[model samples]
Target: MGALPDGVYHIKLDDQQFLTIGEEGAVTVLPAQDVGQKFEVRRASGDNYAISKPSSIWPSPFVCYDGAPAAPYEGTRVRLRVSDFPPCEWKITAGSRPGTFTIVVAGDGQPLTIGIAPIPIFPPFLQLTSSSGKDLGWTFEEAK
Candidate 1:
């Protein structure tokens, strides 16, 4: 796929895990659930799309880099931010695997990668990492 058509979707990390809003609003990879799995994929001009909570009553927080939009160097943490910062945008492009796409930061141009939490209690979280040698494929299934 080139770019995802604007819509709601269940963003899968793999066969079993999906991108979800975890405790304290941190984005994490976990099994799909009724809540927090669905994200609104909206075109943010050009090839960029903004990912947000599909049904939030409050203003949707866009999934973005933890800090100001800049070059997403290795190990930059990913999180939800209330502001509609330009860096909050992402470029969804075809991945190495069929039916999957890679989410790259619109401003920094680095693919979002999974990072293991330092504490075992916490689940795996998303971060910006080097594009080389990283398994950054994500499957976006249209939400019902």
Candidate 2:
């Protein structure tokens, strides 16, 4: 860690590392600790970005195309439309059969991480029906 200037940084750790600030405002490393500890980088005004356990797990709000059974499948694709501040499009696909997926979006100086969990498979044939600014539609099919 070095002089982090009050913004979100994608940090890479050798193991578990503790971050400390020196007297002169320089960032110093303490020691390696927990395997899955999270931290936040913030300003004095309590404005900050935090790294923590995800509050909920679901498909992306911007995702357009999703196929189901909610289980992993090959040739599955997800389309994302970003028409607001960050104007762009993203298409995520599983090469051959679904499992767990992680997608990172980084462009135009902004970054976001999207996580897709393993499909349950209780119901089958999941499909995307509709979408709005921050809303999305999904339907499921019963197994045959």
Candidate 3:
């Protein structure tokens, strides 16, 4: 399986909208923009990653404070744990091609497939600034 390195990625949904994390901990598919458009995917343990906004203290994987079913079922809206240490964590299983991945969530060790796709279209957003740190622009590059 291809491992997703930790960083903010620009992911698009099947509906052509982007996955956005609101400052109030609301996750939604909204139009792309700088605000709430970036997501920080951080490594937790092994191949699991914690998805959250750079400024937020909670991670997306925490959406399972109560246990999850042994298998993923559609129409479930799991709630976040409200803590940094995820009550549940996620693993991105590789899909048939690049940029495609399936989400799996686990709580206290038992992992279960969520069977959802958050199609990542590019790598981290690179900020290009002058020596004085003035704002310039952004660029997309290969993950190191």
Give the TM-scores of the predictions, in the order they appear.
Answer: 0.84, 0.19, 0.56
What's the CA RMSD of model 3 in angstroms? Answer: 12.8
Candidate 1 per-residue lDDT over residues 1-144, each given as its tens digit: 455888998988766788898877788888878888888899997877888887555656778777656556667777777753334777788887888787777764445544434446558777776666556478988989
Runs of candidate 1 exceeding 4 Å displacement:
56-58, 84-87, 108-121
User: What lDDT score is found at residue 92 in candidate 2?
Assistant: 23
Please list the residue runs of candidate 3 whose C-alpha ends up more than 4 Å from where it truly belongs after superposition: 56-74, 78-81, 107-144
Error of 3 at 128 (Å): 37
Model 3 vs. true fold: TM: 0.56
What is the model-wide C-alpha lDDT for candidate 2? 0.25
* Backbone Cα, N, C clashes tallied per candidate: 0, 8, 0
Give per-residue lDDT, candidate 2, residue 126.
20
Candidate 3: Cα lDDT at 33: 72
Residue lDDT tens for model 2, 17-126: 23322222222233433432222222322222222211233321222223321332332333332222112222221212222112222223222233222355421222
lDDT of each: 0.74, 0.25, 0.47
Better of 1 and 2 by lDDT: 1
Ordered by lDDT, highest first, the candidates read 1, 3, 2
Give per-residue CA lDDT, model 3, range 1-144, as digits (tens): 457777766655442556555444445555567676665567877877775545543333343423343443333443334554645556666543445565556334433443222345232221111122221212212222
